[model samples]
Target chain A: MSDPLQSWNDGPVKASIVEFVARVTNRGSSDHVPPAERIAVFDNDGTLWCEQPLQVQVFFALDRMKHLARKDPSLAQRQPFKAFLEHDLKTIASLGKRGAFEFAFMTHAGISEEGFDALAHAWLEEALHPKLGRLFKRCVFQPQIELMNYLRDNGFKTFIVSGGGIDLIRAVSEEAYSIPREQVIGSSLKTRVDTQNGILTLIKLSELGTFDDREVKVENIGLHIGRRPIFAFGNSDGDLAMMRYTLAGPGSRLALLLHHDDAAREFAYDRDFKLSPLSEALDKAASYGVRVVSMKRDWGKVFI
Target chain B: MSDPLQSWNDGPVKASIVEFVARVTNRGSSDHVPPAERIAVFDNDGTLWCEQPLQVQVFFALDRMKHLARKDPSLAQRQPFKAFLEHDLKTIASLGKRGAFEFAFMTHAGISEEGFDALAHAWLEEALHPKLGRLFKRCVFQPQIELMNYLRDNGFKTFIVSGGGIDLIRAVSEEAYSIPREQVIGSSLKTRVDTQNGILTLIKLSELGTFDDREVKVENIGLHIGRRPIFAFGNSDGDLAMMRYTLAGPGSRLALLLHHDDAAREFAYDRDFKLSPLSEALDKAASYGVRVVSMKRDWGKVFI
Candidate 1:
């Protein structure tokens, strides 16, 4: 009862979130929705945490790729793996849209799914942000965590709909955001179940099953969540479709786009990061009916 | 709890289910699973409801295909469509495994995702079982519903993991099983999102994205659930992999295979039903440690 939004600044953004949650939860209010219908989805990466030097997964994959290349020197022959070993950003970027996904399949696949999950969990716990000097999982935004808990306390089922690899995000989601594994939806690999001597194994394949971004985020929401989320938050052009999908739902809906404007507290760049570009959603926020939350103005603190 | 599993008769099958729930839920017990880890999954078709004469979806698809064929007589020129219109069982059977899937894509795809959801919801409500003389949704087993409720009351999150179309199963999951749509993971079609002047739409594609059966079920359990389930139930050989996956987990796991053995109360068959053949799983149940629940022996009543 004491301040669930304690990290949030006393401003219109905080006031608006309080108002929306109140309106949907109050039984006497016309906008009241049943607890079962209150679904809220948030995009990971820039929306929930720091994504400046690189996305957490990109960093994780790079470290893992480097480790794999070290163990088996033959792997460095490939373009992405060679680029990963050399830290050649140019070649990696030149590989275009598939570059990230190709890196994904190479770094993570060909192992038991549970084994990869353990590797991810260990790395997230140990890997420090290059700039933040803190473990990647600890780099999650305090204000957003508060926002999620506040929504959950009001009966919303919070889910992570990310473009990041599902396995990577799931490893850190519970510790970072308190969202459960099942509630996290993201891009995934096609896996086959292998049973040897009655021991079950889910082997992760190199093939990409879903590249969850843009319009495909909406497709995955229908496939995984099977409902139109009443509330959504994101901070990238990649998340515009999801925000639009949330706003298009019938209800007293609320969608917000976070603008990382406080460069002093957090690195700020709308177009600098190729992996998570944000200019379009920021520009179209007003027209799309998504409120913009400025980090400088809306948050009392950034990282927990 | 006033016997939450009252419809289940006094038998070893009922006792084992009760014992498994107690052991997993009791904190002092060596096998105690934390509330969040107590995930249970159930297959749909013959396991949860009557699939005799034909699986519910097949019947519904035939009705819809016939309606479409009647409106456009030229549509009957196609193999499956013509076969559906003619009620040509041999032709449908000859078309083989792809026939059901081909009929699936033909019947459900090309419509707006929400439009299809509404159509499914309407059809499920109005459609009656030929032999049961009741709405298909209402024909759900009372004992299974009781079992689900009992597990849920013990903090287990019950999920429907079936090989049926995700959209088709979702429409009735809430009403029939008290399992929410988001908890239902099944086979799915690829979808594309369209936004025109801020109106968001998801269109179901003709292509199948996943077929959640056998090995694929284990893959999806990893993809969607993000953890191994401790309890699983099914009736077909298609469910053996899921049962193995459940039992192989590091816990006091329980996997039950329902046998449709009471023809007097409900139609009984194992190999007789092509869509839901149950021979291999039933034959190998004891070796795999999956308990077999005979309908005649385990249930006091079949329908709610």
Candidate 2:
């Protein structure tokens, strides 16, 4: 009676998704792909939800830092901690992607995995997006949500391939994107199994184990998923390698990049932005045959 | 009508599994677990298949060494390679678990993930078990297959947590155990995304990453699955930590250790064995409430 992707406009982006799914799912078609190889990966931040002003996980980390600083006041004087305490966004941004991961590891480590998960869950449940004025999970793009559901309904296993903490995204992925914890892959810190107070626990370590960005995304996908994805979606240059890797596989392939150009509904900054930049990928998108979905033109609505 | 686990005798081992599943799946029961939390982990080498004489993977590696040696004849003179080339089982056994892993890393690395997977698949398809005289993949235990299926039918997600190479086991896991590659976790080597002759490939590196044994199994389950398993099955001391970790969860749990005491059906060596030693875990099984299933007593048939 109603369109499943009601938020998506009648454009090439929607048309491409529909065409690809139909071609692959049609058993008699030459392009038909079996259900087992129908793996679709999506970038979490800009591609699925609002990522402007700051990343949602980075925002959560800032809040966590303040809470942690209360117990150990000297943390306020530390380089990265001081950056958060003073609300000096420039210094933190200048630290680059590696710095951002270090910030997350320092703030998120020294606790059991269950304890960290609970903390992240509580924050996501209560924390509101600054611009959206709703719970952060509520800021997800409605069209993308429909596409994920549509793909799953067609026998695809959807996985969130994010550059954020694996546990952080896993805490709320089930509620936000209908993705289970097991399917979410992201930047991870090494964890050690420890018995604290006679309770068996996996304690998060301060050292970074894997950074799920650029080339690392492809490597982790190979290690964890054991197969190349048929479909992939992302927003910036950080996702270029994954898109390339997905397209490199034999048979049918689809890769899309969501362009953040709708400033009225969602903040827009591409080439000039420090986080999730979209310059080189934008220039090479045409050559690579990666579809660039315009947020302003391709969608009837941004968020539900 | 016959019982689902017909290969397993009507005893405490099978009874415990049935009882746990019934209690967890029954909606009105106090121990009823939601479908999302019903995670079951099994060790790959011995718990689900024949691992005597040598771990199946070790056999696979010895075959791989011969193949590699054909390309480079100098490998026959190397220490570990000489052990294999000379057919000196004693030297290889004396090298211990760490040496065994090193041998695996050296033999398995340098190829693309797809390439390595293809090699393993070819080996498993052609190579027969030395003692059983059947394909190595066909050596899987029949009762465990039924248990995995029964648990899946009741909505539990079954995962293979092994100390073997992740890629090696993943090659044949789907057909042998009816488990997908994504649900399998094991010891992993570092893999780099490399562009070889314009074809993008994930090349396996010689360095080991996350040796999924002993305590590391618990840590990996937390990292990959992001939740505690309620059911665990293993055959060696290497799996003791995983069993303890599973039982430490809040609600109903079933942890079983398959004791290799049936020399008639399969080779039996526990306390005196170099690989998959059962000495420490066997002594502590009663204290931890872990049931040790006897192969000679509890299993009606070893393999299908």
Candidate 3:
């Protein structure tokens, strides 16, 4: 068929991405990256889909917390659980990084890995985006999906490196974006394998694992993928470190940040958003030479 | 041109493997596993090569420890260092899991991920297997190499679920087994992203990450691959859990344990290997329905 990224507006952002892929993939070009080294990583929350009101995974976790609380009334008296029960997001946020992680662990842990996978799968299938009026998976950007296909067609191995839970993303990523579970690196909880009644199962534990945010994202890329991605896409400051890491690689590199400047179509807060604040990254894009793709102008259509 | 596993003598072990692969890959067969679910996991140290006297990675780490001691003489008096320096295997062994882990951390950490990659690459390229008298990479089993290629040819994704450090194996696994770095999961040291003097790098920390052996191997398989392997291979009891996990999956599954009963071609030890002891696993193979491939009988040739 025609170029896969044709859904993207005929603009500099699309042009740059196409040109970068062509340059790196050309056999005779000096910028040629071997297929093994052509790793491309994308941030999931805002870059791939809508994460304006709250991250979809967090909402799922909150629902799970309420479900668990119904079984054990004592959970409502606990610190993070109490805050979650009250819908006291400000109080939960005040608890800071450690509190947020503990809350996620309390809600998300204590299940088999497969059980958690099924839970995530069921949630994504049933849950709709409140504002978008569609299933959460359906909120994924059409142009970005096209870009992933375009890159993969050119021999780049595309991966979703998100701040969301790895298990949650792994559930729907393959069906939604053709990105397999192994290629999806993100925050995780500790898991232990148990053979119960001769049945092997991995039980998710109440502990946080490598929090795939900010500097940790770059660290995880090295730990998991073991290769510098030549291409990286993100939408907020949490990805600044990863973008810098990608651009620091010796050969050709492309780093793009999605600017949510389309209030009519999508949410448009940049400097003031608490969850995925884009202030520092937006201000430093010029200094870092990172391409900023505006959601309003760069995409002919947002979602498929 | 011929059947890939030709080095494997025509025996029950060989026949079972071939039949299993054929049944799983056949589209119309009841046991058919789709290409996406055709995951095969292998243990590296003994199953892939020789791990009799010592695991190749442990030897490499010992060498690195001595090298580090040369730089800082104070390390010479440290418990593991003193034991390593004096060739006191008993003292080192007496140090137990925590001590061995500390030794590994001291020797293997404090380098950039790429730097560790280079170190391991250089070691594998230049170092010889003491008794084998061949480059370490060249000591890999010929039949298993053929099996990996054969499985890949049949569209199965083969991975090394090893006890060796992930970075150490990643350096040479691609060339030796054609398994890419990401698919090679193993023990890892904690790492952090560091930007020193404007250069971004992942610095391996002194803390240990997932100690991928025993039940942890199964946990890591679930955590990393997010799929149960349809086929599993191992040579010791450390792999018992992983093999069981693989076999427990639905449809068709194959689990094979390599019995090192060939003292002539290779070392012969099962119950008393100390390091990679094959005691319980070897004894229970029959009851577990795991195929035990005798190295001397099953293979026409050993190393490539």
True contacts kept of each: 0.86, 0.64, 0.68
How do the predictions measure up, each by TM-score?
A: 0.96, 0.98, 0.95
Model 3 docking grade: medium
Ranking by DockQ: 1, 2, 3
- lDDT at B215, model 1: 82
lDDT of 1 by residue, A167-212 (tens): 8988888878989899999988888788644568898888888888
Candidate 1 has a DockQ of 0.81
- For each candidate in the order shown, give its overall lDDT on alpha carbons: 0.85, 0.88, 0.85
lDDT of 2 at B264: 86
TM for candidate 2 is 0.98
Best by lDDT: 2
Worst 10 residues of 1 chain A by lDDT: A93-102
Better model by TM-score: candidate 1 vs candidate 2 = 2
Q: Rank the candidates by TM-score, best first.
A: 2, 1, 3
Model 1 per-residue lDDT tens digits across residues B90-173 = 666565444575565667777787788888988987888978899988879999898999899999999999888888888889
Q: Tell me the deviation in Å of residue B216 in model 1.
A: 1.0
Ranking by lDDT: 2, 1, 3
Residue B218, model 3, lDDT: 89
Model 2 Cα shift for residue B217 (angstroms):
1.0
- Among all windows of 10 consecutive residues in model 2 chain B, the one with the lowest summed lDDT is B96-105
- Which numbered prediction scores highest in TM-score against the true structure? 2
